[model samples]
Target: MMIYLTLFLEFFKIGLFAIGGGLAAIPFIQELSKNYGWITQEQILDMIAVSESTPGPIGVNAATFAGNTTAGIFGGIIATIGVIAPSIIIILIIAHYFAKFSETSIVKSAFSGIRPAVTGLIATVGFEVARTTLLNMEKYNKATNNLLSILDIKAIILFCAIIYLLNKYKKHPILYLVAAAFVGVIFKY
Candidate 1:
């Protein structure tokens, strides 16, 4: 179907550009979420969760998952392959040239320059994800109704506590995620 082809191509582009990791794919995925009604912002957050918990690279997992969600099992397969294809091909090309130019100063300098740019891109993606998840003005709209004020307070307190606890023990990411999920289920009325 045309839909599957589009999914594969878009996700392939996402995979190509997301140089850092799954988090780096957030900005692209958010754009995809907007471009296609195939998913939502909440689903993007959920995709991040699934990607982190999965066995392989988070980007690959996310591509396949989104593909499956959009089309079907074959969509998942195609998207995963499409996304990784460029990386595999590039690596092969690089590997072939690397041996010939492994000691070239210009290539080494180029890599050094690229490393920081990649890190910056990943950091920017993190900020966008955080803004999408937390720092939005619409959250304040919940204060308009007397019944909504309670929800607002709960959301703020739980968010603060989760952030504090996660920061205090940054080593245990899974624990923090579990705690956050518990807070969501218990506090979100």
Candidate 2:
């Protein structure tokens, strides 16, 4: 069907340009959510959470989840492949050329230029996620004047607590994730 084709192509393009990681793919996913009405901002946040908690990579998991929601099992398969195809192809190409030009200045310069751009993309996704997660966009939309009222105090407190714990212990991340989950359930967030 046309929907499946569109999903594949759209996610393929996302995979092609999402140079950093799953976080970097968030902007593309958000755009698709807007462009196709395939998902909501709230669903995007949920997808991020579910994807992070699951076994696989977040971007692939997101593509699969969205595709399944849109169509069905086949859509999930196609979208997952679409999002990873470019990475597979690019890795092959890079592997082929890397041995021959491992010391070339041009290649080094290309990677040097790419690293910061990837970092910027990842940072953009972080801001976007934070904006959605820590702010009450529904309240903001109803009345834009009261910025203070639009902040989600509980999420902010939990975020700060997690940061503090991470800084203090620097332990495994799963501990923090479990703690957050427990807090969310307890607070009914």
Candidate 3:
């Protein structure tokens, strides 16, 4: 019961402030991993991968995954509701008033400002994720002085291959995800 309440409240706060979209919620999820013991950094990465690969919104999926991991099915339900509740309420309010304020400079300026901030947030999350996935910090810390030893060569190669394929093929994302999963399984990544 207490865990459910905590999950709801934490996810509610994330939903309220994660402005752009599911990707925007990632930093908040990362914070949860840091501040609470409910999830780990590795688990956050897994959550992101699974969330992206599965259906529905990534934020809701992450909340459900985290809550379910922490507690149970009921916890997942509560957390999902909590994460989406803010968006629902905000959308309702915006829908009611947006027409009246659509032409106002204040509203326009607010959105203009929000766009850059959201972009920055999303970019930061991307960098963090890349750093965690491509580089092995533990290896870096353990290494005597060899810089190349710190890099996860296999992961980097896989990442580059995926990026190249994405650019060259321009196929649906699911295809890439499936291919990556197959590669990971085959290579034991």
Candidate 4:
């Protein structure tokens, strides 16, 4: 149907320009969600968490989740294909020319330029995610847009705890994630 077609085209555009990786695609996905009213900002965060916890690439996982939510199984299939098509094409093209261009200064310069831009994109996404995670937007809006009142103490404490644990122990991330989940459930944060 038309919905499936639209899903494919939209995700195709996302995959085409989503350089760096899945985190880099967050902004584009946010735009897509906003433009289409396909999902809420909170849902996007949930999708990111689920995608990260799952085995597949975050962008692909997000596309499939969005497509499924929008339509059905067929939509998931089509959207996933659409999202990955560009990567396949680009990889093929790069594989064909990489050996020839690997030593060229122009290619090296281009990659060097891209590296920082990608890092910035990822950092931007991280900032956005942290802002959403640590703040209560609804409370802010309800409290006449007071910034201080919007700060979620539980979230901030949890965030600090996670950071402290990460710095102190340097243990596997899953342990931290599990501990956070347990805290969230117990405190209802």
Candidate 5:
């Protein structure tokens, strides 16, 4: 009822605004902490980890995860519908307009202008994802709020090793993800 509607609207907004993809949506979902009180940053990270490890689009996975977090399976369904609605609507609208304006110079110029805007959006999303994953120290610092040095060293070495292994081997991405998780656990970092 109300819950589903809210879920739909919120996720619809998320889908509409989070242009770059699921990873880009992370920051906005983080902002949900300010109002929803439903999920936390650590949970968001865990959701991302699980989503990346699973099938389908990352954005879809995230919506499912967030929905499940809010109200179990029902919530998940509502959220997923919300996430997809905007794309569906936009595609339909664009299809109609594109057919009508396919040959217009004004339409061509508008598209040319939109291309750069989309590029900028995508680039910004990439930067934000990098900032979250790469810029932060590996773990929380107890006293100074800085990253724990040992944890960081482990992450750096692991990152390099994973990169090298990826370049050397053409294994499935899932294998790399599994290997990274295993290495993280065995190394206890």
Candidate 6:
């Protein structure tokens, strides 16, 4: 009971402030792992992979995954609602008044400012994810001389292969996800 309420409130706060999109919510999710111990950094990485592969918004998927892991099925439901409620309410309000203020310079300026900030947030998330995925921090910290020992060679190779394939084929993203999952299972990365 108490857990459910906590999940709802925490996710609600995330949804309220995660301005850009699901990717924008990742820093908050990372903070949750650090602060609450509800999930681990590895689990957050898994959540991002699964969320990106599956349908639905990443933020909602993350909320569902976190809640389900923390509590149960009902917790996932509650958390999903909590994450989306703010967006729903805000959209409703904006829809009601946007037409009247659509031409206002203030509104335009606000959006112009928000765009760059959102880009920065997304870019930071991408860098963090890549760093976590490709580098072993434990190895880096422990290694006294060999700087290259920190690199996860197998993961880096796989990442490069995926990037090359993505550029070459330009097919639907799901194909790459499936291929990556297969490779991950086989390699145990």
Deviation from native of the Cα of residue 63 in model 2, angstroms: 6.9
What TM-scores do the predictions have?
0.55, 0.59, 0.60, 0.58, 0.56, 0.61
The local distance difference test score of each candidate is 0.79, 0.90, 0.89, 0.87, 0.83, 0.89
Candidate 2 deviant stretches above 4 angstroms: 1-59, 62-86, 141-144
Measured with C-alpha atoms, the lDDT of residue 34 in candidate 5 is: 60
State the displacement of the C-alpha of residue 136, model 1, in Å, after optimal TM-score superposition: 26
Candidate 3, backbone clash total: 0
Worst 10 residues of 1 by lDDT: 145-154
How are the candidates ranked when ordered by TM-score, highest leading?
Answer: 6, 3, 2, 4, 5, 1
- The C-alpha stretches of model 3 lying farther than 4 A from their native spots are 1-83, 141-143
What is the Cα-based TM-score of model 4?
Answer: 0.58
Of the two candidates 2 and 4, the one with more favorable TM-score, higher being better, is: 2
| Residues 88-118 of candidate 6: C-alpha lDDT, one tens digit per residue | 9999999879888867999989989999999
Residue by residue across 137-163, what tens digits does model 4's lDDT show?
A: 777665376678789888998899889
lDDT ranking, high to low: 2, 3, 6, 4, 5, 1
**Candidate 2 per-residue C-alpha lDDT over 1-189 given as tens digits, one digit per residue, 9 for 90 to 100:** 999999999999999999867889999999999999998899889888999978888889999988887888999999999999999999999899898897799988998999999899999989999999999877765445877888999999999999998999998998888888898999999
Give the per-residue lDDT digits (tens) of candidate 5, residues 1-189: 787788888889889999966787777678775678778888998988999978789999998998899889999999999999999999999999899997899989998999999999999987776556555455566687655543446566777787898899878999998888888789896
* Candidate 4 C-alpha error for residue 159, in Å: 0.7
lDDT of 6 at 14: 92
Writing each residue's lDDT as its tens digit, candidate 1 over 64-87 gives 888888788998898898888878
Task: Provide the lDDT at 70 for model 2.
Answer: 80
Residue 24 in candidate 4, Cα distance off native in Å:
12
Give the per-residue Cα lDDT of candidate 1 at 1: 85
Ten-residue stretch with the least lDDT total in model 6? 137-146
Task: Provide the global lDDT of candidate 3 against the true structure.
Answer: 0.89
Of candidate 3, the 10-residue stretch with the lowest lDDT total is 137-146
Return the number of clashes found in candidate 2.
Answer: 0
The per-prediction tally of clashing pairs is 0, 0, 0, 0, 0, 0
